[model samples]
Target: MQNVFSEENIKIISQIDNWQKAVEIACQPLLEEKKITQKYVTNIIKSVKKYGPYMVLTDYFALMHAKPGEGVNQLAMSLLVVKEPIDLEGKKVKIFLILACPDSKSHIKTLKEVAGVLMDQCNFELILKGTKSQIIDLFQKKEMDGGKK
Candidate 1:
């Protein structure tokens, strides 16, 4: 099986100009890997524009995703850690988690795994300041632990 949590899927950037740019940057890896089509990115942005920053799950994190089959090609997830926070309307978000799951079932597992990590303040801080390898390891560890602590 191809590794879902590879270094290529994680990015650490100094900053982003805007929330839309941040979403594009976060989904770039997945787009290049053909995990999702450009439409998926557009859909997420449009959804946010229409519904506001509902994806901003936490003060520092935003989980960007559209419904399944919008353009998802596979079950994949990517992360973008920005050194400086991007303003999503009024919310400040530095961590962008882009998800491209082909179906409902796969996203649940992915969401659970991500929630496990973010639920812990220590892990969340580590990811905010972590190297790409460190972030990859954190996700791998989460998956290995079956989304447990």
Candidate 2:
């Protein structure tokens, strides 16, 4: 809900040629802000090649990331909704949730909240169909609800 993504870190790409490009585009906000180095994106692609896209957490969703300290400048996150799905072997990824965590302990809470959003079909659908501003507002709503009294 509350993350780097909440503050102009969201991207709505029409399509990408490959998953690697998807990762790169998703990391753009973090890269622009210097929250992560180019090496971070490289490392993440390498990890996916060697280990596979375990990040494809569920239907129409994928969570992209590198290990903590692998070019991380801070604990921040970015989200990219690719209008055209990314094919990972056979899995299709429409949402790319990228996170740059300063260290191991800093990412869990944010990751959990993000995973929650992805797990809900309605929420995920909203992301797929929403405009850039609507997408931002969707997460903002989640953030506000997260802090309920």
Best by lDDT: 1
Q: Would you list the clashing residue pairs of candidate 2?
A: none
Please give me the total number of clashing residue pairs in predicted model 1: 0
lDDT (CA) per prediction = 0.86, 0.81
Which stretch of 10 consecutive residues in model 1 shows the poorest summed lDDT?
1-10
Candidate 1 lDDT for residue 90:
84
- Clash pairs of candidate 1? none
Error of 2 at 3 (Å): 4.0
Candidate 1 lDDT by residue in tens digits, 1-149: 13457888889999879989988988999999898999999999998989998899888899889888879999888889999999997899999999888988877756776777888999999989989988888878877776677
